[model samples]
Target: MDRRVYGAEPSERDPGPKPGRAYVELVGGPLDGMLLDVTGWPPQEVVDGAVLMSEHGAFGPGGRSGYEPAEAVAGAGGVGRFVWRGDVP
Candidate 1:
């Protein structure tokens, strides 16, 4: 795997992957271009999707980003994709 940090500050923001941690790519929506850590995620949570919070969002911050699992995309390493559902205030 390439495993290169893409955007923001890895240590302070994305934090990509650590020794035992894993992450999924967030596609579209306010939290687009972000990586979500799913290292110890429950099997059901990965399947059912997740609602992530963003301090900096489309509406200027402090909103929830809804995402659902989608088919894996190339370069995403079969880690799956999180397609945007919507944002909640």
Candidate 2:
């Protein structure tokens, strides 16, 4: 599978897998928190969906506890959740 990393720094670019498959990973933060897999979807979509879910209290106190919006996308493998810290901006 292919891999990529996104953040404030320059995002990594790599040749992806075959047309149908997607790569996924869990990004870890402090206190064992995680950022869900968002391999195939665009960053904007992930943020937008997360915001909508958050506003509606979709996942209760824990955001996207099981199946995250990104994971629900067509090419996604499965659901995953992450804990966010600090200001989103």
lDDT of each: 0.67, 0.35
Error of 2 at 11 (Å): 32
Best candidate, TM-score: 1
In model 1, where do residues sit more than 4 Å from their true spots? 1-14, 56-59, 72-78
**Cα misplacement distance, residue 36 of candidate 1 (Å):** 0.9
TM-score to true structure, per model: 0.67, 0.22
lDDT of 1 by residue, 1-89 (tens): 33433244746653455655456778888777666767677676777778877666655566777898886433333467789988787
What is the alpha-carbon lDDT for the whole of candidate 2?
A: 0.35
Model 1, CA-based lDDT? 0.67
Residue lDDT tens for model 2, 1-89:
33332221234344223344433333232212323335677655554443212212334443332222434344444434433332121
